[model samples]
Target: MAKKDDRGREGEERAARYLEERGYRVWDRNWRCPQGEIDIVADDGRDLVMVEVKTRRTDRFGHPFSAVDRRKRERLWRLAHAWMRAHPGAARGRSVRIDLIGITGERPATAVLEHLEDLR
Candidate 1:
């Protein structure tokens, strides 16, 4: 695989570990269904979170989270709706939240992680 692709996978893994450690139950990674890919799907018991993970090796370009723009938010919203519809019980009366996981570094140990909740 390409170096950038590998870096992204590593970032996602780190984010997953961090979320799990915080008592969040991860439902899926790279969950896709025509709408788009949700890097991570998790539940913090009270709500369902659709996570968009932006991983970068450096911040020279910009902060990783900056990559998730308005268009991306729209797609995430659609995907979240589809997910809830398919698993109605999972999201019954529960709020839905969009999150951004910003990761920067070439390796997990050197990475910086930032979690932006309720992005939508």
Candidate 2:
């Protein structure tokens, strides 16, 4: 994999661990379809969470979370629907939520991470 890809995967692993520590059970990672990709899909007990993870080596350009723009949010919404359709049983009895996780640092273990939930 490319270095950037490795960095992203590392960030995602960190994000997954973070969520797991908070009691969320992760069901999927890097889920892709014609619409787009969801970095993480997890169950937070009462909700099905679709997470978009953005990782950066530094904030020289901007914060990682700032990369999730309007267009990206729209794509995530579509991907969330696609995921539900593809995994019907998982969606049952659970509310759907969109979440964003941002990580900034060279090392995954010591990265600065932020999670924003419930986008539109």
TM-scores vs. true structure, each candidate = 0.95, 0.95
Candidate 2, 83-102: lDDT as tens digits? 99999999987899999999
The lDDT per prediction is 0.87, 0.93
Candidate 1 backbone clash number: 0
Q: What would the per-residue lDDT of candidate 1 be over residues 50-74, giving only the tens digit for each residue?
A: 8888888789999998888898889
Task: Give the root-mean-square deviation of each candidate in angstroms.
Answer: 1.0, 0.9
Top candidate when judged by lDDT against the true structure? 2
Model 2 regions lying over 4 Å from their true place: none
Tell me how many clashing residue pairs each candidate has: 0, 0
Off by over 4 Å in 1: none
Clashing pairs in 2: none
Candidate 1 yields a Cα-based lDDT of: 0.87
Supply candidate 2's per-residue lDDT for 35. Answer: 79
